[model samples]
Target chain A: MRIGELAERAGTTTRALRYYESRGLLPARRAVNGYRTYDEDDLRLLQQIRTLRDFGFELEETRPFVDCLRAGHPAGDSCPASLDVYRRKLAELDALIGQLDAVRTQVGAQLARAELEAGAALPGGPEPRCELTHNGPTD
Target chain B: MRIGELAERAGTTTRALRYYESRGLLPARRAVNGYRTYDEDDLRLLQQIRTLRDFGFELEETRPFVDCLRAGHPAGDSCPASLDVYRRKLAELDALIGQLDAVRTQVGAQLARAELEAGAALPGGPEPRCELTHNGPTD
Candidate 1:
């Protein structure tokens, strides 16, 4: 199949296929007419690449899976190297989720505080209880 | 104050200040010697931008806060426009956190399944219960 057909069958774009090829992950042979040609095996390799990419794996991280498929493994994760990539990806996702969670907490707190302050500053609003207490007495 | 001093006081880099200036978010006046000059007010604006950036707000999103500060508000979030930005940022962060949570679940499942398969395929491993069930039916 040509690049377009392969990309279509893999549910991706030709540009993405070209990017994989450029990264040497999915090299295609040239036909006698000088057009890029791919076989069913190439389609399988591309599907593997696309699947990992959809899982948010970086292009470089997909290399091991692509190599495993090219090496005749039944599945991309059939190789130790591919399994290592999965472990690393899991860790990366965990760390990212942690960081985002922290940021989310801080942002939520800031928003709540700012909204409270804005509300308190409205013209002719009742004085906050804290202010009344602070002015009322010294012990 | 010079650009470097402004950046230092804001806990950022001169390069970043220049970038903000290029985007017209923090334009600085020129000194008589053709050097960039900023005042304490610029430091306040830069600090507001940096704080929001740390909170994961995009540069464009921080523009309203900077504008609010430049308009002589006591703080960046002292204006209705700044509060609007806060609301939008909160929504964006919530959506992103949801997406990341979904991805984390998927990646975790994939890792668990792959590890199970890998363990089952180990050399000289005991036959899985499903394999015994299939062979028993055949026999």
Candidate 2:
């Protein structure tokens, strides 16, 4: 089928298909009229790309899986390169989650501290603490 | 002090200070020569904005803290509005961490499954499993 039909069948946009073609992720066959065309195998490749994308894989990261499929593997993950991409993606996600969690903890602490200070300064609350003290012995 | 001095003290670029000014997070005074100037208080506000930004808060998100400091609060986070921003940031961080964690789990699972399949299909290993079966065995 043509680009539009393949995009429609794949639940993606023609623009995205064009971009994939530009990136050489999904190269299309040209008809005698110079129109881009795709076959069922192309649809399967597109499906694999979409699934990896939905899993938060970057467009570039999906290349290994696409190459694996084009190499005629039964599944996109059937190649060592695709498995390597999966491992790298998992590590990146883990590191990102760790950083975000640390930030969340710090933000949470700041919020709690600020709220407590605000509460203490409210009208009719306990008198604010004083830090002044005599250096020498008091009379 | 002039914009240059403020930028130097704040460890940021004049361009960033100008951007904050454009966002109205920091409004500078004009010297008699028409050059933008800032005071010690503006330095405090800028510091607050910078700290929050370093923590991944959006430029817009730093407004309440800047406003709180401008309103004569002891700290940028002293006002209720600042506390509100903190709460919102914490919630945003939590939701983001959750989503990333989910994706990480999925990617990890996919990697493990793929590796296992690759292991099972290694050359010279046990025969691949066959799904076909006869309804009855010959007596």
How much TM-score does chain B earn in each model? Answer: 0.84, 0.85
Per-candidate TM-scores read 0.86, 0.86
**Residue B94, candidate 2: alpha-carbon lDDT:** 80
Name the best candidate (by lDDT).
Answer: 2
Residues B1-139 of candidate 2 have per-residue lDDT tens digits of 9999999998889999999889788998898899998899999898888778778889999999888888888888888888999988888888788777777776777777777778888765753432211121111
**Per-residue CA lDDT of candidate 2, range A32-131, in tens?**
9999989999998998888777777789989999999888888788899999998888788877777777777777877777777788887667644332
| Number of colliding residue pairs in each model | 0, 0
Interface RMSD after interface superposition, model 1? 16.0
Stretches of model 1 off by over 4 angstroms after superposition: A123-139, B123-139
lDDT of 1 by residue, B29-76 (tens): 999999999998888788778777776678999998898888877677
Q: Per-prediction DockQ, in order?
A: 0.28, 0.33
lDDT of each: 0.75, 0.81
